[model samples]
Target: MATNTTTKKPAAAALAETAEARPERATRRAPAVVGPPLGEGQEPVTVTLSHHHRIDGTDYTPGAEITVSPDYARGLRGQGFVART
Candidate 1:
């Protein structure tokens, strides 16, 4: 039997990809169509809550929806919240 293998990017590459995709890097600083600019320096951030059928390492089910500000999300990003998927 033959084994299949493929080259994978490192964790740093994943992080870089995420950083590149951040809203802060928008090419044009356009105005927001709904309620102030998303993630603007001033004003509270808004996020939609979603319930997923599954989650990792957590005993809760079906899942939980949480709304967090951009500021709060930054903290969560470092604490494995972004890894939940």
Candidate 2:
């Protein structure tokens, strides 16, 4: 076998290079109130997004109504969603 001469990059430098190759991800803001949560002993409510938002790789356009559980709706509320009332 023939002799070869080569140099390896430092770990930090390699990481920096990889980081630069990836695009920055969009940042998310706190969810706003659109409507009140479901009433006591009531069924799931139909909710809509007040503004364009993205959650967990899913895009939710404004004015879109979706039937979701009260618990889930509450969670979505923090993610900028609101009930349709």
CA displacement after TM-score superposition, residue 85 of candidate 2 (Å): 6.1
Predict model 1's lDDT versus the native.
0.46
> How would you encode candidate 2's per-residue C-alpha lDDT over 1-85 as one tens digit per residue?
9866788899999999999998898796533423345567868756777877665455678887666657778787887667445
* Alpha carbon lDDT at 75, candidate 2: 80
Q: Per-residue lDDT of 1-85 in model 1, one digit per residue for the tens?
A: 9876977889999999998887685584322322223365544443332233222333222233434456665654565444355
Which pairs clash (backbone N, Cα, C closer than 3 Å) in model 1?
none
Q: TM-score, each model?
A: 0.26, 0.37
Off by over 4 Å in 1: 1-62, 83-85
Q: What is the lDDT, from 0 to 100, of the residue 17 in candidate 2?
A: 95
lDDT of 2 at 46: 66
> What are the root-mean-square deviations of the candidates from the true structure over C-alphas?
16.5, 11.4
- For all candidates in order, the CA lDDT equals 0.46, 0.68
Candidate 2: pairs in clash: 31-80
